[model samples]
Structures are given as structure tokens and as C-alpha cells.
Target chain A: MSFDGLWPYIYIAIAGWLATDLWRWAGVVAGNRIDERSEVLNWVRAVATALVAAVIAKLIVFPTGTLEASPLWLRLGAVAFGGLCFFIGGRFRQIAGIAAAIAFLAAGLALLGV
Target chain B: MTAPPESQSQSHWFLLGMRGIFSLPAIILMLSFVGFAAFTAEAKVPVEQVMFMTGMVWALPAKVILVGSMLSGAHIATAFLAVTLSSVRMMPMVAALIPEIRDRRTPTWLLLIVSHFVAITAWVFAMEKVRDVPRGGRVAFFAGFGVTLTLTNIVLVGLVYGAVSEFPPIVSGCLFFLTPVYFLTSIWISARHRVIYWALGIGLALGTIFAVVAPEYDILLAGVVGGTAAWWGERALRRREAAR
Candidate 1:
């Protein structure tokens, strides 16, 4: 079989796959050389956490996809409710928080439909 | 490096990690994905292409970025840069997690391989759970969660790709809300330092502001600028406390 025009898939691979994986490989290489308990590792951890926090905020404030259909208050309010349960759940914090969010969100959406 | 007490404890880490398949984080991820199919379906991207991306790109945000840029008819170079910027958070995630997973016995090659699975959900879950796990088992534990998550989401996306648009908007909206809920709490609870609190607050404030002003580079600017500010801000505080 001869290789024909497949620039779209080729473009997908280069842009989609390589772009994302580049950081993972870099992280490993950088992580390998550092002392485990070093302050530098702490800083890197901080950066990662902040980056994800940005993602979470963006999802709530300016979401894409179907979530964008719901009112922004419903979105932010569910997280607030979830965060409350997370702090209160103690041992099962993650589960409690997520369950609370879904319960609150689904309920709010249903109520809004009425 | 792990504490002395934890390292001495021996357990079947692979089984422990693999057990993450049943965890809430895993379930919530599936829930978030149920509504994700519409984006790809709307784009008229083939199911096979979505499957291909699910395996190769792995990160949900990165996949969204790719499909989004394509929808806008962006150049390959722009998409490349966007995806790269979007996934930049994965770097520190891998960097921080590898040290935790590597005992003196864990190999570099193994860490490199598992690094591919370090998406936001998996990384946050492993970071939270691995504290109680043995260092020798941390890698297995994380790999179990990461690999399980990736495979499960791939299958979930495939099943939903053809079935998404029929769902009501409210239902889809609520289902997709699981991610931000799970993410915010997990990220808050998993932070190892108070500086992370600073980072979170600053990141959120700046993320919101930037989304309004500079939509294209919001996450990038907020993440880098907010993260760095929190980092140095905390350091300077520590220096002052030490001087007293």
C-alpha cells in the first residue's frame, strides 16, 4: 500500500499527541535529577496545583459543552455546596463532596426546569 | 522519599492501585464524559478519530482544545501551541509524583512509562491516596489508577459518542458538573502547603478575569502568573518568619 494524502490525521498526531506528551516526558526528566525532598519539588507541586485550580475555575465560570447551558449560579453554587461537604466529610471527604455537588446540581437543574 | 514507618509496611500495591477502578474519582470521570460526546459529534469528527485521540491525547482538556481549534479552522501550529500550553500543568504533576512513587528500588523506565497517565484526575487522586501507601507500591498504585482511568474513559467516550445529543441540556449540564466539583475539592484537600491555598485563590481570581479579557491565553497566563506569585509570596513570608 502506498502512503497517500493523509495530512489531516498527520496534523492531528503532531498537534494533539506530541504537544501534550511533551510536558510529561519533560517532567519525568526534570523530576529524576532533583533531590526528592528539595524545595524545588515543592515549588513544582505548587505550580501544578495552581494550574489545575485555574482549570476548575474556568469550568465553572466559562464552561464549554453542555454545562454551558446551565446558569452560572447553578454551577458555582454546586461547587460551594460540594466544598462544604468536603471539609465536613472528614474521612470520606472526596466522596461526600462530589456526591453533594451532583445532588445539588441535578436538583437545581430540575427545579429550574419547573 | 517516604517516611521510615510507611516504607516498612508491605502490601500488594498493584491490587491496591487497580482497585481505584471502583473509586469515586473514577465514577465521576465517567459521569463527566457522558456529556462530552456532543462536542465531537457536533464537530462531525469521526468516532474513530475521537477514539484515536482518547488513547493518544488522554487529557480531556487537551482533547477539547484540539477539537476546538479544529472547529475554528485554526492552523496546525496554533493548535499545537494551544494544546501544549493547555497541558503544561502535567509537567509539575509528573515531576512531583515521580519522587513520591520512586522508592530506592523503583526504576526510571517504569516512572517514564506511567508518566503518560498523569492526567489531572488521576494525578490528584494518586497524590491524595498515595500518602498512606508504601513507597515501593506508590508507582503501582498510581499506575493502576491512571491506566484504569484512561481505559475506562476511552470506553465511556466510545459508548457515548453516538448517544450524547439526545440527552436533555439540564441533564447533560449536571452530569458535566461532576468534574469541577470533584476537581475543586480534591485539589483543595490534596495540597501539601498553605502556599497552594494562595495559588488556588489567585489562580481562580485571575482565571475568571482573564477569561473575560483574554480568552485565548486565560489558563496559561493565570496559571503561570498566579502560580509564580503565590510561590514567591510564600517564600518571602517564610524568610520574614525566619528572621524574627
Candidate 2:
């Protein structure tokens, strides 16, 4: 409620987002004529994809927020269930499976009072 | 390939879908930030400042470090340094995207504006689809995409701040589940190379192990070790293939 209390979050948000913008600008500036299929783009795609993957894995394995409280088995089950759904539903159906896995896990946890 | 005017329309819609889905993710991601702000608000971290940073910094990890360091009583300089260390990942990200945007001479002004909201999520989606857009149209598409996400995130933060209790830990936990679920799905759907499969295995193994041992540097350490191992593994595979 206090103005003083609000400032830190604001500062963090601005600085964090802006620092990243610097690169997008650089990409636009430098991307003037490069081929998308070239080795560089492929590496970028691979690494970026890899990082996003790593982030997802980290969250499942060591979640911070609400997830931190959920039992480890539930988290792993949700991921594995989601993985199964992903494989079963094909590409688009996988999104729903993710939601379902989480929902199921959460419901089970709630029922068990864990 | 130049995206024809009509294809551009379709692609625009596609980008819009990508942007809109971010709202769903933002609904969850913002909760942690809002919760952190609300929890720490009495301690002097600005809510507006946090909201503004969420918009400006767009990247969650850096934003967390910047404010977390400051909250810990670290000076702005230290906060900046820590955030910058995390920002190092963006260098390789930029190196990869620049060449893809080649061919279109987007005006300097628009690039400046679009750059502000470019985050890992948008970059991944854009990289996949940018090739379909001609060099010139990429900016507009990216602009439209970035703007959509920026507006959504701001609204999301505001909502999270206002409705903090509605999304209790259970809801928050469920929401947080989206990141991993989404990424895992994307990898399963798109990964083609054996190298990628190996990289993922190594990254997950090392990342999980190191995460427990050294929570602070897990991502960076896993990335470096796993990435290098994957690279070498692929090289070795290629050599064997050639020899055969």
C-alpha cells in the first residue's frame, strides 16, 4: 500500500525487461540480410529451444511459487502424465493434456490434503 | 521467402494467437511477481516499479534477480551486475536471431520499439514463424506480437495484484505448471536431431543434479556443460558416420 513498498518491484521489472530488449534491437539491426536456414540461425534455434526446455525442467524439479509446496511425486506425476498426453494428443492436443495433468495432480493433492 | 500480402494476413493471425496465449501464461507468471511485491510491499519495494519492470524487463529471471538483490539490501550496482550476469544468455539469443531477420530493412525506429518486449517466449515463437514472414514484414509482425504481450502482461500484473488471494498456492502451483508443460510439449513436438535429444537428456540430468547441489548456478552450469556435451556428442556422431 505504501509508495515505498511499490518501488522495488517496479525497478526490478523495468530493468529486467529493458536489458533483454537491447538484444532484440541488436537482432533487428544486425539481421539485415542473413539467411534463416544458415548455421547461425539453426544454432540459435537449437540453443534457445534447449534453454526453454531446461527452464521447464527446472521448474518441474524445483518450482518456487505455489509449486514448491506440492509433493515431489505429484509434480513428477503431473509432468509424466502431461508427457503422455503430449504424445497421445499429437501436437495441438498436447496443450490440453498439460492443463489436464496439472489439474488432475492438483485435485488429487487437494483430496489427499497434501 | 517473401510472405505474400495474403499470407501476411494469415501469419498476422498466427502471431496474434501466440501473443494472446501469453496472456494465459502471464496470468500465472505475474502472480509470483505480484505476490512477491505484495508480500514485500510493506518492506519498500514499489508495486508500480514492479509492474513497470515486468513491462520493461519482460524477462522474468532478470527481473527477479534485480529486485531480489535490492530487497536483500544489495546496492543498485550489485543488483545490476547480477541481472547482467543473467542477461549474458541473451547474447547468444541475439546472435541467432539477427541473421534470420536479414533481407528486411526495418526502419530503425520500429526496431527500437519492438525490441522492448522481446523475451524468450516471443523469441522462440518468432524464430519458428519469422521465416515465413518476409524480412520487411517481420518487424510489423513482431511489433504486433510484442505490443500484444506487453499490454496483456501489464493487465495481468494489475489483476494479480488485485486478486492475489483468488489464486492461492494451489492455483499458483497449477499455473506455474504451465511453463514446464509447455516447454516439454514444444520439445517433444519439434525436436528432430539426435543431438537435440542427447542435449536434452544431458541438460536435464546435469540440471537436475546441479539444481539440488547449487541452486543458484544450475541453469548456467547445466547449459554450459550440457550444451558442450551435446555439441561434442554430435561431432563424434558425425565423425563415425563419415568413417562408415
Q: For this target, which candidate reaches the highest TM-score against the unseen true structure?
A: 1
B53: Cα error in model 1, Å: 0.5
RMSD of 2: 4.5
Which parts of model 1 are misplaced by more than 4 Å?
Answer: A1-8, A90-92, B1-11, B242-244
lDDT of 1 by residue, B1-244 (tens): 4657444433357667878888877887877766667767877877777777887888889989888887788889999999998888888878888888888777778887899898888888888899998666788778877877788788888988998867777777777677877788777887777888898888888889888898877887887788888888998999999999
lDDT of 2 by residue, B1-244 (tens): 5877755564675475456454434344444456544443434554566567767777766766766776677765566667766665565565555565434444667555666666666666565667667665566666667677666766666665644545555665665566667656555544555666666777777778877887767666776667667767676878899999
Show the lowest summed lDDT stretch of 10 residues, model 2 chain B.
B23-32
Predicted model with the maximum lDDT: 1
* DockQ, all candidates in order: 0.54, 0.43
lDDT of 1 by residue, A33-106 (tens): 77887878767777777788888889888877666667888878888888898889999887888888888888
DockQ category of candidate 2: acceptable
Chain A accuracy as TM-score for every candidate: 0.85, 0.73
Weakest ten-residue segment in model 1 chain A by summed lDDT:
A1-10
Clash statistics: count for each candidate: 0, 30
